[model samples]
Every structure is written in structure tokens, then in C-alpha cells.
Target: MNEDERVELVRLLPPPARPELSADRHRLLRGHLMSELREQPVRVRRGRPGRVVVPALAGGLALALVLTGGGSASGPDRSQAPQATQAPQAQPSAGSAPLNAAPVAAVRLLNQAADAADRAQDTTPRGDQFVYVKSVQTYPSTDEATGEATKGTPQNREIWRSVDGSRWGLLVMDGQRRPTGQDLKDPHARPDEPAPHPLGGGWLEPTPGNTGPSGYAYAAALPTDPDQLLAKLKADTKGQGPGPDQEAFATIGDILREQLVPSPVRAALYRAAARIPGVTVVDEVTDAVGRQGVAVARLDSGGVVETQWIFDRSSFEFLGERTVAVKDDGSWRKGEVTGQTTILGRAVVDQVGDRP
Candidate 1:
């Protein structure tokens, strides 16, 4: 493969140090690969950490590598070829199937999420308690020299909100800079360091925006039926964008990502999403925090980006949300990650600025 193809292939591998891999993903990939090998007269061999070797086969040839981005394991040096090995053919049971063979329906995934949410300890916070959340996000930027897409340093943001909105909220954010290596050091270069925002937190008044508890409470009280919930979403999002359906779809993600709704309401939200046209499921996806999960996405006709919400495959717990450019529109490159947010922590605390 050429240099550009190698880079693109590396991007397709799963991250090596994914600590938050859901059980379902593990099972699905394992079963799928095993079933595929069982049907072929090929021998599989393991290489260095994160590298898998599958000999050239008759029907088709496929390779799967789980490794860190831009690492040696991800970018294999193909200057030399390996010896071939013969393996015995075995039969895979009916239960062994690729995730694509029998994918979970969108409605089923939504109900599964609802069940998990129902089991969660989502306590209604007291008026004085602050709803606290911590997240890390990285925005994409273009390299001035190569014009390749790159990510800026991950910024950590902490927010605290009064449950009743009677008092003010607090927000703290920090940014960091990448270090210039010693070999390529420039006169103006400095060590990799954090450039935190001002020591004090930004104060916020209760409002109807996604940053406040009002939106959370509103989502919590939304009707649980899919039809009613979708109607409400459509009605609220009308005139906000070019297409009401796309706006409604975007609004659902906003509400889920920014609010802490009740279990039934959360289920209703997912189910309502399934009713939207163009909704589709991706068997695998990764979050900004290196967590892996399944995702549900829809093409937003009103915008140039596709909004995707990710969840743990087994428990169906929310992991993060992201937006990718559908086509190059000069503002962003095609397939670029325009926005991403990974939730690190969330809880209810008794005082402002208190982290959970």
C-alpha cells in the first residue's frame, strides 16, 4: 500500500489501549472472526501485541489489528513476507455469528438502554444540590503544512449546576499545548504543558439553554410514548433549521447529551429516534476517551455533519456523542470529526464547584 493508504488503513484498526471496551463488542468480534476462519481453510497466527496475522486465503483475505493510532503494530512493515502455515478446518456452531449477520434492531437497542437506565440510581436531586459533570473533548484542526486533519489537545471542562436553577452555575475549563520534541526543537518551543483557564470558574444564571437544569427537567418530564415524544421534539425544533426532522433529530441528541432525564423518558427518546428516517446503526465506534461502543447515527439534511450517539454494546450505557462531516464543504473536510464530547464523570453535589 502507498503511504496515504497505509495511514488510512491504520485509522481503521481498533485502538490498542481501550480500557472501556464493552463486553458485546468483544463477543461480536471474537465470534465473527472465529466463524469466518472456521469456514475457510486458513490458519490464523498472533503477532506482537495488537497485531493479527491471517494468511492469504481462497475466498477472501481480511486482517484485523487492534492497536494504538500511528503505532508500529498499526502500520506493519511489509518489506518481508512471512512463512505460511496450514490449519485444520473446524465447524462453527449456529450461535457463532457476525454482528452483521444478526444485528440488534434499533428498537431493541433502545429498550435495552431503557432497562439499564431503570436500574441506575438516578436520584432526584434536592434544590440545593448541584448537578456536576466533567468531560474531555478535542476539536479537529488542519495542519498548515500538509493540510491533513489533526486534533488539538484534549480540553477538560467541569460544570456544576443548581438543580432548581434558583442559584448560579459554575464552569471550569483547561487547555494544553503539545510539546516540541528535542530532535526538532525550535527556539520558541516549550515543554508540553497545560494552559489552564483563569483560576476562577465562570458563573452562569439559570436559563432555557442546554447548559442549565431547566432543559434537563423538561426532558425528564417528556412523555414516554415514542409517538408523543417524537411529536413534541418536532414541535419544539420547528423553524430552528432547514428541515424539521433533521432539527428534531439533532435536538434529541442535544437533550440526551446535555440533560439527565428519567429512565422512561430516556427510553422514549431513543425509541423516538428510531422512528426518524435515515437512522442507522454502526456495529463499532470509539469515543474521544478511547472507549469503544456501538453507535446510532443519522444524516442531518439541514447540516453538513452527521450526528452519532454512542453507547456501551452490552449495557447500552451512554458513552459519548460526536459529529462527522458528511462531505467536504470547505468549512470542514469530508469524514472530519467536527465535534466530540466524552463524559468522564457525573453526579449531584451539595455545593457549587464540588465535583462528584
Candidate 2:
């Protein structure tokens, strides 16, 4: 088949079947594509008419859904196991319209941050439907000596919009680096499968013996709270080289491990944030998650504006979050949420605890 034909054929396969392709198939497709670029003829013979052709591997790795980054602190390892845990439950209340009863200061700041992120979202959408992509995870890496901070590869750049706030349409980019190893635009939420979710599952197999899907068992066995998750850091410290300073480092590490990977996890942050003395909520929104509700938090702290989207309002199924911080030099830098643009661009900023 020619490049165009092969591409079209690949597109014809079912979503579930796409990722099962072998390396040879991806190589074949690339070969055909490159050859066609050189004005080569179709290499494969004409098999009667198009027989609903499905290549051995229909889906190309768009960008290697299961792998990325030059460092080992990121990406999935087959031998690694996953943690299982339930997202926390936020302090409940009526929906946004009644947010007047919320803290006055929190209301003010949340509105500001939420507005900024919403604007950013207005400017960008996930991507067109004809696109292909995979999901990955990212964390902030720092310069050891200077303590200088750097923006890391995002798990993915995505936009999900739902009018009634029930269902979400995924706007995904092919090859966008993310903090989780899953398919961003997965169609189904199958049991025990690794796929992206607004409130995604957590990894339990922290062991080298447990890697990727083999070591991963989904759901809430992984605690999303600050205190409960501390064990992971202690356990991870075993044969690996030394880690950062203990208390702050462990706290930050815990934050990085939990924040924005799932809506529930993020929601836990938001609930904790609401309890802060100075912080205020400017806006509050609730969207349905299956049967549960997700609360969008818009608030302010220090000088930066933060926003959080927490799914499973009654629980801590955090969907995602974005924070935009004003710098001391009169400039601005986005706070890391799920390690990407802190602004998901929503009218109300939500979620909290300032991820490291």
C-alpha cells in the first residue's frame, strides 16, 4: 500500500486495537511514508480492492504513550508496581451560585485565577479529531547546585469541555509529554487498563518488580492526603541514591506524586486549601463525575492566582489544576499542576496547597 493508503487504513482500525501494534508495523508505516515522500511507488501489491485493511499494528505510538524523557524519575517501567488508593473527600457545600457563604477572600482570589486560566483555555483547544496522541507524566526537575527551577515536559496539553459538566470531550495533542503513562484520548474506562482519565487512577507498584500495566492495579489504594502518602517516599528511598532534604523534600515529593494525576487527588489539595486561614474562594463550581461531583476552586495566595478542578466532590477525585503566579520582578510564571500550564483557562481558579 502507498503511504496515504496505509495511513488511511490505520485510521480505520478501532481505537482499542490501535495501540496493540508491534514495532515492525510502526516501522513499516514510517518506511512507506518516507518512501512516498521520495516519490516512490506503492511497495505492497494491490490486494484486490481495499479489504478494510488493518495492519499488524494499526496505531503508531503517536509519541510513545508509555515512554518519554531522558531521565528515569519519569515514565513507566514494566517491572514497577502501582499504588492503589481512593481520592479524598472535600468539605461539601451547595453549588457555586451559593458560594457567597464561602470565605469572602477565597471567593475574590479564586475568581481572579479562574478567569486567567479560563482565558488561556479559550485561546487553546485540545486538537482536531483527526489527530492521534498518547499520554505521559512529567515532574519538575531542578538544578542541584543553584536550586534554579525549570519547567518540565507536560504530561499532555489537553482541553475538555462539557456544557452541563457531565461528559467531557477530550482535546488531545499527539506526543504531548505528561506526568502519567496512559492514552489521553482513550474511549473506554475498562477495568485495570492504563488509560487517561479526568480523575485517573494511581500507581501502587512502587517496586521495581512492578512496572507498567503488569505491576499496576488501578483505584484508590494510593492515599491522596499529605500524611497518608508519606510512606511512599520512605519506601522509595531504599536502594536508590540519596534524595533531597527530608521533611520539605518528602512533602514536595508527595505533592508531585499526587497532584493533578487524578481529579480526586487534586481535590484533596483544594479541600486542604479551603481550610487555610488567608486563602479565599472567589468562585465555586460543581460538575458530575459519573455519579459524584467535582468542585472547581478559584482562589489566591501569596501573590499568585491558583485554580483547581476537583472531581468526586464528596471524595478527592481531582480532575486537574493550573496556577499562574506573579513573580517578584513584576513578571509572571505559571505554577505547576500535573506539571503543565497552571492555567486550564477557566473562569474560576480552584484546587490548592502549592505543588512543589
Candidate 3:
């Protein structure tokens, strides 16, 4: 096959059962390839009508490199990868007064949260199962014509994701249901096209490994050591967002919000988040649903906005997340909430539309 066909073939194949590279190396190599791609021009065939270029080819190539231990003679130094440690057990301060009493240390709260996560029951779903998550969320919508941003009303959202990235999933906003994943059988369909419906419809392509963070296989494969996890997060998200530290924090929040992470991995994520610079604790905060809770927050590199992950005071369970403007940055006033979400529930189910 020619180069174009070779790339396309790789793209169509299922992802490996386990990544060939260690998580840190995989992310680092993938990040480097992406950086190189950004600096170069993407090549497309002259007459290929309907073939969309796949950016995830970077990940594919990275995976191919370290296959069978061909790329690196010696594996990554295990000593340098973050070592797992037993965190101290600490109880949350009693009652509502502690929520308003004083600002607690970020590390203290994260360690407590990690301990709580470690104590939770561990559930590993089968490859055919789905992860269901329900939440209420709101964000500022910018009007294209007027160029003005307005805060939107809260809306209920629900999603079911394939556990092993091999099945079609469903997304429900308000009351409308929409199918996700690409219809692979359509003659003219692109690989990234969305599914038409759930009934007698086209065959859905497997979910791309790079697309969904909440996929069980993906979450289960993450490094369970905080230092290594942080390293991988930084390498994988190198140049995408505002900054590495901020992006790492946001990535951790994303994983925690909707994903059914293994207990050790969940605890590791919390501990990893504690290592990020600029993380702090807010005395009190309310989620989109008006539930009051304490928050672990970090200021953006610009210092104008702060992102917070809220948690129940007594239980240390994650409640939701919100973003607030810390400085008046033309569009928003200080203390104004720019975005918010409250997670109602999450569980593993047998099918696309099934709930917990």
C-alpha cells in the first residue's frame, strides 16, 4: 500500500489491548509528534473526495514506534516514575462551620479526598458495558453577531459511553436523545461521522481511543502513581491549553467528573493534582444546582479566571466544578461565574440508553 493507504489502514484498525509504550513514554512521544505536525503541512491526496485527514495518526505512529520494544532499547527508568505512597488518613472538619471557617490547605484536602477515594468500592465493567453519567451544567454563550457573551440557563445532560471503545453510545440533552460514534458502513461516510440512530441503522465504528476520556479501558490504563501520572498529563497536554500546570489540573478534573476510575487510579489522580502549582482551597462554593460545598481551585496562567472542583464537606465526595473570574477582564466582572456543572450520578450499565 501507498503511504496514504497505510495511514488509513492503521486508523481503521482497533486500538491495541494495551498500549505498547508506558503511559509516560506514549504521551511524550505523542506530544512530540503532534508538535511536529503543527509545524508542518498536512498532506492530502489530490482527488480523494470525502477522506478527512486524521490527526490521531500521530498517536498511531507513536504506538507503532515502541511496538515489540523496537524503538527504545531500554525502557523508561522505573525509579524516575512516581512512586506510590500510603497517604495519611484525615477526617473532614465537622459541620457547616468548617466550610466557612477558614481556607484549608490544598494538599490537606486533596490527601483527604484521596483517602476517601481509596476506601470506595472498586467496580470494573466488562468490555461491552457502558458508563452512564448525569449532570446539570451551564456556560456562557457568545453571540456571533453581537459579540456578547451571556450566561446560559442550567440544563440537564446525560451520556452513556462504551466501556472498551467498541460500541455506539448515547447522549441526552434536556429530553432529546442523540446517538454517538461514526456510521462505518455508509459508502460516503467519514470516519468521524456521528451515528444516525440507535435502531436499524448503520454499523457504528469503534470509539477512537483518543476521543473519550471516560472510557473504562482508557481510565484503567492510566498510571496509578501520582508523579508518573502528572508527568504523563503534562507531556500529553503540552501545548494545547493556557499552560501545562493549568491544563494538567483541568485534565484531572475532567477525568474525575464523569469517569468511573479505578480506586487506586482515582486516589493517584487526587494526589497528583496536589502536586500541581497554584492549587488552593476555597472556603465555600456553590455548584450549578445551588449545592454548597468546599472547593479545590487553581488560578489560570492569566490570573483572570479560577477553576474549582467542589466536594461534599463531610464525605469528601466530588460534587461538581465551576469557573469564576478573579479579575475584571473586560468581558466578565470579578467573582462572576463563567461556567458551572453539578454531577447528579454515574454508574455502569448494560446498554446505551440504560441508567444506573
lDDT of 2 by residue, 1-356 (tens): 89888767656653321224456655665555433322321122233331111121212232233222122334344232322344995654763222222333332232332223223322211212111112233446777997766656644433332222222223443333244333444555334533444443332212232221111111123445634443443354444433322322323223423222233433333333433343322223332212332233333434454444333332222333334342432233543242322222232111111111
Backbone Cα, N, C clashes tallied per candidate? 1, 71, 0
Model 1 stretches with alpha carbons more than 4 Å out: 1-104, 140-152, 175-199, 208-214
TM-scores for candidates 1 onward, in order: 0.59, 0.24, 0.65
Candidate 2 is scored at a TM of 0.24
Could you tell me which 10 consecutive residues in candidate 1 have the lowest summed lDDT? 61-70
| Candidate 3 runs further than 4 Å off | 1-104, 177-205, 208-212
**Top model by lDDT, which number?**
3
Candidate 1 clashing pairs, residues 3+ apart or interchain = 16-67
* CA deviation > 4 Å runs, candidate 2: 1-173, 176-279, 284-302, 305-307, 310-317, 326-329, 333-356
Q: If ranked by TM-score, best first, what sequence of candidates would result?
A: 3, 1, 2
lDDT tens digits by residue: candidate 1, 1-356: 89888777666754444243356755665556544543342122444321123333321222232111122343445433232344975756795533322122443455566667767776787766777878887777788998876656678877776676666666776732223233245554334322322445455555533342235567766889988989988887668876877877888877777456777788778777766776655555788878888677777775587788888976788887888887887767887778898888778788775655
Between candidates 1 and 2, name the one with more favorable TM-score: 1
Q: Give the per-residue lDDT digits (tens) of candidate 3, residues 157-240.
A: 887778888786666678744433332244565566554544332333467562545567767888999999999989878897
Best by TM-score: 3
